[model samples]
Structure formats: C-alpha cells, structure tokens
Target: MAAPAPTAIRLHRQRRVLELTWADGRRHEFSCEYLRVFSPSAELRGHGLPEPMLVGGKRDVGIARIEPVGRYAVRLVFDDGHDSGLYSWDVFDELARDEARNWTRYLERLAEVDMSRDRDVVKLAALVGQYKPPQKPGG
Candidate 1:
C-alpha cells in the first residue's frame, strides 16, 4: 500500500466527529473512538516492539478537544478525558490502510479480554468526572 502524504492532509473537528480531507480532495469521516483505539502513543503502541492495546467501550467515543502537537501531529482528547496519545503522519498513514482489518482485530481483542469498549467508555467518563469539577451550565 502507498503511504499517505502529510502535505495532502487536513483535519476538521465537528462535534463528535472529525472530517479529514486529503490533498487529493478525498474526504473521510473518522470518529474520536476510532482514532483513540488506533492511537500511536506508547501507552497504546508500547515503543518499537509496540504491544497493541485492547480498546473497548469506544462505541460512542467523541473528541472533546484537540491540541496540535506540531506540524506533524495532533493530540486527540477524547470526551473520556484521555489526551495522552499523539498521532503522527506515519501512524495516520498506517491507519488509512485497511482500517477495516485493524478495527476488526481490535473488536476481537476486546472480546478476548472479556471487555466491552462501549461500557468501558462509560466507566472512564465517570472516573474523570470524579477528579474534575462540574462544568458551568453555559461554559
């Protein structure tokens, strides 16, 4: 598979989804959950010998915030408050290739671990809320 070019990439956040536009003008809608599960950070990738993680409870994952990590990457802050992973050009390229297969394997891994992404997502949100103060009504 040909690797994607960073020069041809653009990312737009919309509520719970991100719309990515390639230089070639092709666009794709990717959710925060999809991006999170596929994060390239060591927390999920584990260095060069990256040990893949089982990301469950992401059926409803949404992007709560976004931080540009540089011209080469973007940190995706999930609604669940997970903002550790930094996605790079290389990693995003890999994600674009046969993403269906990758996602399928993730689901399988979740099952193997007896976990549910959707349910775990709910738990994560709850935990983060415990430490962070409640948001203002219109803030």
Candidate 2:
C-alpha cells in the first residue's frame, strides 16, 4: 500500500513556495527554506549521524529547478547550488503531515543555539511570520 502520489505540483516563484496537490485532494505548500533545511540528502542528514545538522541562513533560499526522477521522486536544485537530494513521494507525504511540528522544532533548535535564519546577520530577536518564541520564566 504505497502512498498516493501528488496530482499537481506548482512552484510559486513570488512566494517561494512549492505546492503539491495530492491524489486525495490535499494540498501542501512548503517554503523554499523549509524544503532546503529538510532535504533528505546525506549531506544534510549527516551521513547516518543520530541527528541532522542544523541548517541556518536559508531564509531567502529559492528553488532553481525541479527534475523528475524515475516515477517516484524529484530532485530539487536550490539557488544556493544544492541539488543532491532526491525527494520521494513518501518523503513528501511525511513532511506535509508533520510540517507544523517539524517547523516548531526547527525554530526551537535555532533559538537554543542562538542561530539566525538570515544570510549574513545574526539577530537574537529575529522572528518570522507568526512564530512567537516560547517565553522565558521571567522576562
């Protein structure tokens, strides 16, 4: 019982989002930064390490190209010159399902390390969109 494949895929250049409409009529939109950070490439996956490397400074990353692979995956070429990951249908489904939780965890990890998502600057209080950092015990 394989997961159902996406019926349509659209890249919104202006928004920098990759949108996939699955066969079940569910649509998932992924930001370019999100996709890059979550890429399944061994490079990002850390070559079998217990945890993946924390990718920072991808707030403005964009997908340069998308190439189909056989019948199960697509290779995403990022503007930053990354094109190693082969994203499969299964991976896409899993990502879509866990997007919220995954994003929160990523942000938390960044906060833990005082990392920045900006390309060349590190801001201790730079937050994006509607992400409200967890409050400290006493501010």
Candidate 3:
C-alpha cells in the first residue's frame, strides 16, 4: 500500500482535539491530554529505554499552539509550557492508529504498579524539580 498524504489538519483549542485527514479520506482524532502524556521526550521517556514514565492528572490538558517544523514534523507548544518534542508525520499517524490500544495498556500498567498518574505541578515539583532542557543540536 502507498503512504497516506495529509489532506487536512485541524486543531480545536477549546476541545483539545487534533484531527488529521489523509488523502484516502481517513480521519483521526487525538486528545491533547494523551499527546501531552505520551510525548516523545527524554523528560517523559528516558533515553535508551522503552519504559515510559506514566503521566496522570492531565484530565484537562489544553493545546497551546502548533508550529510546523518542516514538511514532516511539527512542534507542539503545550499550554503547560512544554514545547519540546518534535512529532513527525509517521509518528503522529501511528499514535492516531493505535491510540486506544496504547492508552488501555498504559492504564493497565499503571494499575499493575499500583501507581496513579493523577498529578499536579505542586506534587510533581516535590518529586523532581527545576529541570530545564538543554538546547537541541542545530536548532
């Protein structure tokens, strides 16, 4: 099968939904909360590890802004001042396709570890604090 070309992209700031339509007429919707938690960043996921840090208490995350990087990737500036990870088209497509399954697995893992993702800034700072990301190379 050929790769799908993006036909349209929409972001609903109020609803916190990012929608994408492909050339083949397939559409997908992803929530800002999910994107924030599952961000592909070292802060969220450590380097050289597939194990991810569970994120919770993001029942109300909002989309701040979406900036196009190039033809393939986009920089998502979240409302919570997280504007790091660069999401490419393929990565986004995978997230859209397997969102439900991945979320289910994440929840299950959290439950198995007897952990709660529900967290506020006050609570998180107590755990790990004042981390400013170093500049990305060639940026």
Top-scoring candidate (lDDT) = 2
Identify the superior model by lDDT, candidate 2 or candidate 3: 2
**How many clashes does the backbone of model 2 have?**
0
Clashing pairs in 1: 8-23, 56-117, 57-116, 57-117, 57-118, 58-117
lDDT of 2 by residue, 1-139 (tens): 6677789989998899999997677998999999999999999897667656788899999999999998899999999999999999998988888889889998888877668788434464544543778999977
Best-first order by lDDT: 2, 3, 1
How many clashing residue pairs appear in each of the predictions shown? 6, 0, 2
Candidate 2: stretches off by over 4 Å: 120-139
* Model 1 worst lDDT run, 10 consecutive residues: 2-11
Question: Cα lDDT of model 2 overall?
Answer: 0.86
Off by over 4 Å in 3: 1-5, 113-139
Q: How high is each candidate's TM-score? A: 0.69, 0.82, 0.75
Give candidate 2's root-mean-square deviation (CA, Å): 9.3
Q: Scored by Cα lDDT, where does model 1 land?
A: 0.69
The clash tally of candidate 1 reads 6
Best by TM-score: 2
